[model samples]
Target: MIRTATPADVPAVHALIRELAAYEKAPQEARATEEQLREALFGERPAVFAHVAVDDVSGETVGFALWFLNFSTWRGVHGIYLEDLYVSPGARGGGHGRALLTGLAWICVERGYERLEWSVLDWNEPAIGFYEALGARPQDGWTGYRLTDGALAALGGSGH
Candidate 1:
């Protein structure tokens, strides 16, 4: 039961984000507010698109995957950058994760996207295995970088 998420799903989405952060041992960093999520996701220019997996009988969201389109200059085709994917602890290993991945793959194929990409923490070996089993491989030569609030401010002040 996977479907696109709507504005009405913000609360549940926010809760899932918090849960994922907690699972990654960074609960305090899960500070996304409902208003922020709503505006970013459903605004005139959406920041990302979300797909949620719901339990058939319970009608509760069990997992979700958020993604945005990115261009691969080298490949000369669009790609899907998977920002996040989380399945509730109780619902894991119940095919939800695989279903979500399958749904994302379908989106890629249907839209003619050349690639689908995501990152998993080095400590999460199980996730690595899961992704590998799904035929996803790590881009060996790449490293991820980020700029947070203070760093972003400093960079802005530097004025290049």
Candidate 2:
């Protein structure tokens, strides 16, 4: 079952995040702490939201979807920007991932949002196939970019 993550679910979700990072071959980049996640997800005026998927038999939180709002200039509507979605390896064939995504899609449709989007690593062919099976297509012409670490600081004119 998929449901909104409560504060009690933070640690489990945090672990799931580590698993995701490892799978993505970037374990070193999973630096956010549990306290940071708690504050981000449950703080006053929260800027992020999360949902967890529970195992039917074990009742364990086996998956999670963390997201935030993004505004589309062309559509003039706020859409969900999924930051991460992960399901435990043992739970892969149980549809947890699809259920998590379906929940987000429901939110978009219910709120009249024009888009539900997230980026997938180019080398993760299994994930690409899964998303395609769900009727999700790549935004072919657009390239994703980010400025972080020294580049981000330098651009902001702040020496780190």
CA-only RMSD, every prediction: 1.0, 1.7
Instruction: List TM-scores for all candidates, in order.
Output: 0.96, 0.97
Residue 9 displacement (Å), model 2? 0.4
Top candidate by TM-score? 2
What's the CA error at residue 47 for candidate 2, in Å? 0.6
Query: Candidate 1 residues 26-142, lDDT tens each?
Result: 999988898998888999999799999899889999889988999999989898999999999899888898999899899889988989999999999889999999899989999
The TM-score of candidate 1 is 0.96
How much lDDT does each candidate structure score? Answer: 0.91, 0.96
Report the lDDT of model 2 for residue 121: 99
lDDT of candidate 2 over 52-106, digit per residue (tens): 9999999999999999999999989999999999999999989999999999999
> What is the TM-score (0 to 1) of candidate 2?
0.97
C-alpha-based local distance difference test score of model 2: 0.96
**Clashes per candidate, residues 3 or more apart or on different chains:** 0, 0
Error of 2 at 140 (Å): 0.7
